[model samples]
Target: MAAGGVSPGGPLGAYVPGTSLLHRCPPGPKLLGLLVALTLAIRWPEYVAVPAVALFALARVPPRMALAQLRPLWLFLAVAFGFQVLAAGLGTAIEVVGGILLAVALASLVTLTTRVSAMLDALVVAARPLRRLGIDPDRVALLFALAIRSIPLITEIVRNVREAQCARGAGNNPIALAIPTMIRTLRAADALGEALIARGIDD
Candidate 1:
């Protein structure tokens, strides 16, 4: 399989299971705070932002996971920032992208420290006011749960597909690789749905 490699599970899916203070904090505070922090990041342009972002990132995850979380986006951030600098000289671009990085890192921190179930519950509760309408909070929560769970799940599929191709001595053909992976992923999704049903999560 001499074609290309995939990235690690991005920070959202790179949650390290642990019992740090971050891990112990109620999911609600983290979720609510994330919403507020994101609002500030988007609403305010002139504030010195990097340190706020850095502090947020450092507070939620282990040092090692923090480093790993930055791995996937490093090159992309570099290229985007580099283009910005080239296009408009350095200063403003540096300031802007640094703030952007913090926003991303903040999101990663929330996803990293919080469990998937907790995230699902938060989404459901937030949308609960819509329960009077046609919205089904439980189903919506399940959808979110599936969405978050799918990140690592799909990452695993790609990993397994690469390993399979290596064993079969097949060269890296995107179509061939993708087809089998897609089939396997659909099967996994169906199985997951069935399991949820069995557990009454779909009820």
Candidate 2:
């Protein structure tokens, strides 16, 4: 997606415009809150995961939609938590997974409520002090925006690739799926690079 163009929301995990309190909240505060929530989740007691789950509730996104954002991670989470269980124990595993999920949910909430431009502006403002280090805040902010915006685009691409493969009865073939997905992803990246260069952002 271009910096100025408004892309449609993604399947399942895209932002839904709303007038709720979380939707009205400023991106800066929401970002700070996410950081704090993540920190607490990582370092605090198991009970802390409770309120972390509550944070998603405060975001007011539908339960099904929120689950959609998380469903993709289940396989990864399962493997990771399984390791924790073997190395530590069930209780420790639960705490770790719960904390991680809470953190992810909080981040998803921020993305859902905040606009891409608003997020970039917030990042630029936060990066102002880094000027002493010879960093370009605008460039850094643009990079951040591109990274966030690409998530939905990439998700959509994968969905399309999977559906295409399934329609051809090749869905079970990893090679078929991986090859096209990689080719498409690289093509998209090359086009994005060309667009950036054309706009005089070659650096």
Per-model CA lDDT versus the true structure:
0.73, 0.79
lDDT (10s digit) by residue, model 2, range 34-99 = 788778767774656677557567777788878888999999999989999999999989878887
Model 2 C-alpha lDDT versus the unseen true structure: 0.79
Clashes of each: 0, 0
**TM-score of every candidate:** 0.60, 0.60
Would you list the clashing residue pairs of candidate 2?
A: none
User: What TM-score does candidate 2 get on C-alpha atoms?
Assistant: 0.60
What is the clash count of model 1? Answer: 0
Q: Which stretches in model 2 have alpha-carbon errors above 4 Å?
A: 1-13, 83-88, 138-203
- For candidate 1, write residues 1-203 as lDDT tens digits: 12222224443356666676667777888878878888887777446366564654556556777767778888888888989899988996787687777788777787677776566676778888898898988778767656655766788898899889878876387776898899999999898879878988754
Whole-model lDDT, model 1: 0.73
| lDDT: worst 10-residue window of model 1 | 1-10
